[model samples]
Target: MSARYWALIIFIGSIWGTSFLFNAVLIRELGPITVAAGRVTIAALVSWLLFFALRKPLPRDPMLYLKLGLLGVFSYAVPFTLFPISQAHIPSGLAAIINALLPVVTVLVSHYWPGGEKIKRHKAAGVVAGFTGAALLASPSLAAGNEHGELWAIAVCFAAVMLYAITLNVARSFKAIEPTTIATIAISGAALTSVPVALWVEGVPHIERIETWAAWIAIGVFCTALAFQLMYRLLPRVGTTNFASNTFVTPVVAVLLGVSLLGESIRPIHLLGMGVVFLGLLLIDGRILKIWRKPVSGTEVVSPR
Candidate 1:
């Protein structure tokens, strides 16, 4: 990967990683559904204002809007809702760690994406390592309290990852449009689609807690809109493989956020697990470790049909 790609990776990883901290803080204050509603609402409004301010016209094609809706529902709306619900059942740290499966899911989904990255053995091994790290990350939580609940919520986390996998691949076709515009459409759709449920479930949120408001604002502006826009901008330039590598790094950053900012304790096992996971990510990345693994010659490319 290029240096620019590496920089982008760290930037994206930090933003996404800290999202767990945001979720944990806000969920405590506002509850899951309400927190999600507030997040999407805030993101939609900010993006819309930015969209209008930039004087960017909406897509002339209505079909694009439809596509955006599908992408939004799958990518942001469903996963956004399900994640918090799962977090309600599971711990936020565990939820974030379980989300470590994203690269594996992304690789699996890429196989079906036309003109996308090739899935190879190293990638598979890396996915295994990532899960190992994730398992280590969640092991204490899983072993100690409410194993069934944790397991159940982890299942939902997997579903959310699948949705994310689909959305990342779908964004490839949206290259004709700016990432910011696509983000605006997606968040707007999510806000509108989720409003009824939000109203029915939570009814006008109080938004009294400063921590809750901070989390909501961060999610709306940084995680949802800015992060999506950044991901979109980075993807075309760096290619999806490098962009997807953020999946490997985000958990580490999340763990750091939990420990440092939130004052959560970090166990030795967690560190050991992170080391193994990093090794796995190296296996997946095809940059550094591929050299030692030696090169495979005579590559063939087939178009997705």
Candidate 2:
């Protein structure tokens, strides 16, 4: 990959990483449902504008719309709300560290899918390590035995990440759809699901603070909308293998932003947990092992022309 591609990948990761910050900020002022609803609403509007500007038509199949609608609810609406709810209790940086488990969970879930990627020996070990790290992160609350809210919040974050992994697995069926179209439809559906619930549960979302507006706009536009646009553009050029690097970069940026800018403090145990989780991710990625593996005597190395 070129320098431009590397920069773009990092930029996308950085943008996504700040979403934790935005959630922490927004959750202070708004209900979790309202915060999520507002985000998807803004993103949905932007997506519609792009849909028209780019001259992309909606999918013709009714079944596809049904699928996308379900995805919207599960993928965006539920998890978006859950993240804010979780952040209300836990530090944004810790939440970000937990969020890193998404890909690992995906690997575990996809193994059960028909014709999905089978679990290799390294992948199995990686999954075990990933869960072990998660247990480490959860240990403080578990040991305390009284901080149920914090423990529950951690579980909720894991649940949200699991939803994302499930959504990704299901979204593989959308190979026939344009990435932009899928996003527009899914986000639009998310808005539709979340808006009514927000209105019912949270009322009209009165915002008196300017900071709230700023945070909401940043999350909606940059984190949700523009990030989706950037990802689709880069995926074809960089390939999914390269794009997965964002998983590593995002949490690091999130941790830094949470500590420095947000004035959040983390324990040494949290750092150790994060390190273990990352080690698990590296194992799952298999790049290090591949680089070190020596070829068998009969094996052939095929060079690209």
Whole-model Cα lDDT per candidate? Answer: 0.76, 0.88
Q: Write the per-residue lDDT of candidate 1 for residues 124-146, one digit (tens) a residue.
A: 88777877776776676668775
Specify the highest-lDDT model's number: 2
Position 102, candidate 1: lDDT: 75
Which lDDT tens digits does candidate 2 get at residues 1-305?
99999999989988989999999989889999999999998988888898899998867899888789888889999999999999988899999999988878988998997767888888887888888889999999988994658899999999999999888888888867898988888998999989999999899988899999999998998898889878877988997667877878888888898899889988888889888888788888887678667455448979999
The number of clashing residue pairs in each candidate reads 0, 0
TM for candidate 1 is 0.84
lDDT of 2 at 161: 97
What clash pairs does model 1 have? none
Q: Tell me, by TM-score, which candidate is best.
A: 2
Q: Weakest 10 consecutive residues, lDDT, candidate 2?
A: 289-298
